[model samples]
Target: MKTILVTGSTGQLGNELLQLSHLEKDYRFEFVDRSQLNLASEESVRDFFTNKTSSDYLSIINAAAYTAVDLAEKDKHSAELVNVDGPRNLAQYAKSIGAKLIHVSTDFVFDGNHSRPYNETDLKNPISVYGKTKSDGEDSVLEVNPDSIILRTSWVYSQFGKNFFNTIARLSKEKESLRVVADQIGSPTWAGDLARVCFSAAISDQSGIFHFSNEGVASWYDFAYEIVRAFGYHCEVIPIATEEYPTDAKRPAYSVLNKQKFRKTFEVQNVHWKERLYRLVEEVKGQKLT
Candidate 1:
């Protein structure tokens, strides 16, 4: 069986990929968290590929990243190290060993000024440190390995991590009223859906940038409302503009990504955001009942 190395094994997307790995028996997986393979350290990355595994890997899925948007502003060095330098090292190593590298990126790479959904060909003008670093990481991977595939996604959430869904669920149980930003618009992508896409990209021969997200658009308020309502909570969710909520990082007011390229290239059916959200909410509720 072909071996595939998955970095950031404990993260939301990484965990989802691990859960689905059993379905694909053709490929053997080596899931490594930061302790096993530190992407932020160049020496660690080199030593890992050299001595850690006995056989060569067919592909390396780089799911690790410094995803703290607000913390990235004060901790620019750490963010750049993981988001930019780490991917560069991975790409270089993948090139030397003749392994395909699938790097995950964010929709924050765009400035969100466009009136319509962003396509792969759209110009990137990142407004935040996290966005700039991720954008730079994408360039680094492609520069080091022309065959590398960069998958950009938006508003990623999952049951495993600290995400909007769980946050709202917790808040709904704790508070009677909640306020969410309504001006910023984007699609909430379930990490499971994205993990499947990443796996498909890893096996495919296609090499380029692609955008993937759950179908449809929604504001943060809409998302929060759905989460609360799904859980049968009585919390009043109030919609507020982006200006009302101040943060260290400047978020894109509109970062919805177009899925035409990804759908056409991968021939994968995209799930509607609401349908996936409902399924996930129901699953979480079921787990709690048990």
Candidate 2:
């Protein structure tokens, strides 16, 4: 069986990946959360690789990242330490051991200036600190090992973590009205779907950048409205422009990623975002919110 080491095992997508590990007849997956392996430190990351005992077709699926967009603006160095240097160290280790490096990235890498969906060949001009760091990480991974695959995802949410969908569900139940940005548009991705795609890419693909997200596009308002409607809830979703509700970091007005290259290469069918959203709602309906 193939042995895969997953970093950031406590994240939304990382938790979803662990769920898939129950039926582990085909592969053996070893998970390491931040407490176990601090990717931000070279010594810590090096220690992880040095202690690995399994050599059965090794693959490192790095899902760890510094994803606080607003905070990243203030903590630029900390962001680079985890997002850029962490992946660089992992890539270097992967190269040394001839292991496949599958690194997760964000859609923020694009400047969101294009009218149409972005393809894999699109030029990146990230405007925010978070995007810049992730873009730097992508460069580091590719520069170190040509055999590395960088999967850039957008607007990811899940039932297991602090995501837009869960927040909308919680706020909708508690409040009469909710305001979401209507100007920003992108594909709403489910972390579970991305997890499956990552697993496939780790086992099958050669090296290159690919875009993966649930099919279709919608703004934040559209997504929130859909969530409440799907769950048979009565909540007023108000559409507000980005300027009306500002954040420390600028978001892409349009970051829709085209998954044609991924579909063609991996032969994996990416489902529509709404379909997965329904499944998430069903899964978390009974869970208590703090």
Candidate 3:
């Protein structure tokens, strides 16, 4: 069986990918946490491939990244280590061994200046530390391994992590009103859908940048309202401007990605954000009832 190495096995995306192991019977998934393979340290990454697994990796899915957007401003070094250096190391290693590498990136690569949806051909103009690091990461990966696939997504949320969905659900119980930024707009991507795309890209011959997100655009306030309504939370969702919520990092005002490239290349179904939110809320509620 072909062996697939998945980094960040415990993260939102990686965990979602783990659920698909049973379906792809032809490929054996080898999961690893940070302890087994630290991307920041070249020695660790080098040692992992040298001694850890005997079989050559058929595909490598990199889901690990320093994702705290606000925290990234204060922690540039850490962010660069994982975001830029990590992918660079992986790309170099993947190239040496001829392994198919799929690296997960964010829409932050673009400065959110575009009035239209961002596609793979869009020029990257990162406005924040996190965004800059991610942009650098993408360049490094492609510089070493042109065959490597870069999957740029935006506003990702899942049941596993501390995301917008969980935060709204929790705060709604405590606060009667929830204020979310109304100015910034982007598509909310379900990590499960992203995980499926990662697997698809890994198995395909197509390589280059691809944007994947749930089909539809929404602001943070719009997303919060939908979450509260879906979760049956009684809190009133309040729309506030970006100035009201000051952060350490500057967020893009718009980051909706055009999925025509991904759809054209992979030919996968892209679900709407509202529909995904409903299903996820229902899934969580059902799990709670049991």
Candidate 4:
């Protein structure tokens, strides 16, 4: 059986992909973290694939990333090592071995100045160190391996890791009210949904940049409100301006991506953010998910 090597197996999307591993029975999934194949070191990547033939992986889903947006500004070198050099190394190896590389990127690649949704072909003008590294990573992947598939998603969250959802969900239980930035707007993406799309891209012949997110858009405050309501948490979610919650890095005011390309290309549809969140809460309640 061909293998699907998934990096960053501990991440939210990585774990989500692992949960769906049983769905693709024909392919053996090799889920590796930093210990197995550290993307930052080219030597580590080469050593990991040493003695292995070109037919080993059907696709290498690069889910590993240095995702701390604000901290990226303070530590540019670390971010570049993981976000820039990492994908480049992976793409080089994938190209040499004739393997497809499916890379997960971010909507942060755009400056978020547009009132309309961003298409796949939009010129990226990332405003933060994190965004720039991710953008550079995408370029490296495409340059090294033209056959790579790049999926630029926005505001991703899940049960496995720390994200907006987890933060708000926890705060809702502890505090009586929560304040979130209402100015910054973007669609929230569920890792499970994105994982399903990654698997589809892996098996399909598609190769290019595509945007993926939930059906509808929401501000941070809107997302928080829905989260609190989902689990029957009585916390009041208040809308606050971006100025009130200042961060080290600047954020895009509107970064919602156009998913027409992704949906039409994959021939798949996604649920709205609210409905998806509702379903997830209902489904995970029985599993003892916090």
**Top candidate (TM-score):** 4
| Ten contiguous residues minimizing lDDT sum, candidate 4 | 281-290
Instruction: List all candidate RMSDs to the true structure.
Output: 1.8, 1.4, 1.9, 1.1
**Taking the tens digit of each residue's C-alpha lDDT, what string does model 1 give over 1-290?**
88888999999999999988988999998899999888888999899778433256888899999999999999999999999999999998888888899999999999999979999999999999999999999999999999999999999998887888878888888899998999999999999999899989988999999999999999999999998888899999999988898999999999999888887889677788989999988888855321
Candidate 2 similarity to native, TM-score: 0.96
Q: What TM-score, over all chains together, does every model reach?
A: 0.97, 0.96, 0.96, 0.97
Query: What C-alpha lDDT values do all the predictions have?
Result: 0.91, 0.89, 0.90, 0.91
lDDT of 3 by residue, 216-286 (tens): 99999999999888988799999999999999999999999988887878977888999999998888884
Worst 10 residues of 2 by lDDT: 48-57
Kindly report which residue stretches of model 3 are placed more than 4 angstroms away from their true locations once superposed. 51-55, 286-290
lDDT score for residue 117 of model 2: 92
lDDT preference between candidates 1 and 3, better one: 1
Candidate 4 lDDT over 169-202, as tens digits, reads 7889889999899999999989999999898888
